[model samples]
Target: MKKILFLILCFPWFGMAQGDGLSSTVDSLYREDQFYVGVTYNLLSNQPKSLSQNGFSLGFNLGFIRDMPINKRRNVSIGLGIGYATNSFNQNLLITKDGAGGYTYSILNDSQTFTKNKFSNQVVEVPLEFRWRTSTPTDYAFWRIYTGLRVGYVFHNTVKYSGNQGDIKLINVSDFNKFQYGLTLSVGYNTWNLHLNYNLNALFNDQANIDGIPIDMNTLKLGLMFFIL
Candidate 1:
């Protein structure tokens, strides 16, 4: 009768010890000192009618977060990162020639009429996000998702005109308002993640005037992310 009573008293204590050990291991393994680097691909999904040609932009980022407890098996984190992105586009042009006989001839050229009219831009961005995990926030083979906002600025914009190859359109931009605002969504398993993002800001600043034509830019991005810790 005494042995039975002792075993019952020790059972809860043994279970509690095991649970504490697991929690301590998780806490140590997923400390704030770790870091991650990942890649992103973005596509221009929304744009004004004037800007018909859009392309895929590729980018990369490195980040770190301090984990905060939410539950025994899950946690949340605040993460920050910086990234670089570049996308290029070649637009088609219709050409018309005046004949010697005072008649007009139009040529529908499938070829890129502007051999040099292609345009490209590079952007630098900062991301602030919240990450949540189904298992320990930093554990392997766990399901996770992060949704956040991003602010990006265009550092470089260059357009090569088809009619004039040597004279590239130089756009001098200075202002944070010219920067883009967007939402970022991601899903991951273990160390691998996939992302989709949409830009909420217009491509061209309100004051931007190109040949008296203003353009809006928006993009959709699909990419894979590899987490580093």
Candidate 2:
């Protein structure tokens, strides 16, 4: 009788151990790349003939993305994110206000000397992405390529100038376009990724001009992107 009872208890314990082993090995489905941060070298694009970039334009970006997998393999997905960005562009263009509540736009000639001339904007941005990766539920490192569009609303803008005209600072000077949109691409493996952004619209509105020429300047940014779960 004791031998039969011991066998019955041993069988139950063996079954329990087997169940635990299977549970530990089977991988569960998971989400990846829900948060991200980046830094970029901002470049002025579609510039006028006399206009040239005087200093390096730089920008920082940080955001969160909602990762949604479409395929059964979970390798193809869509991402939507919201983020904040601040950018600065340094150039020779000058902006000043007129007596009639209007604004004046000018490009400094070589004869004109200025210590500082630049403009900056802070924006709230949204990003939509189509993402593809070689990632599985069990893998921690994988290759990914993501392409997307980003739209931004400029909440604050400023222009600063210091030179022969003395120090002049203007706030929300009325020429910058409050709405901005751009195309974005990110590609890499593991934690390091290369990111690119190109703005499709001009940075300023129609009122900004230099000697009857429209200063329809846009921006291009190239940088690195770091993603985290």
State, as a TM-score between 0 and 1, how close model 1 is to the true structure. Answer: 0.61
TM-scores of all candidate predictions against the true structure: 0.61, 0.87
* 10 residues in a row with least lDDT, candidate 2: 7-16
lDDT of each: 0.53, 0.85
- lDDT by residue (89-164, candidate 2, tens digit) is 9999888988999889888899889989999999999999999999887665789999999999999999999999
The digit string of per-residue lDDT tens for model 1 on 111-218 reads 434444444567777877777766543344566787888788778865445453234453433311347778987787655567766788766555443334544446
TM-score of 2: 0.87
- The number of the candidate with the highest TM-score is 2
Deviating ranges (above 4 Å) for candidate 2: 1-27
Report how far off residue 32 is in candidate 2 (Å). Answer: 1.4
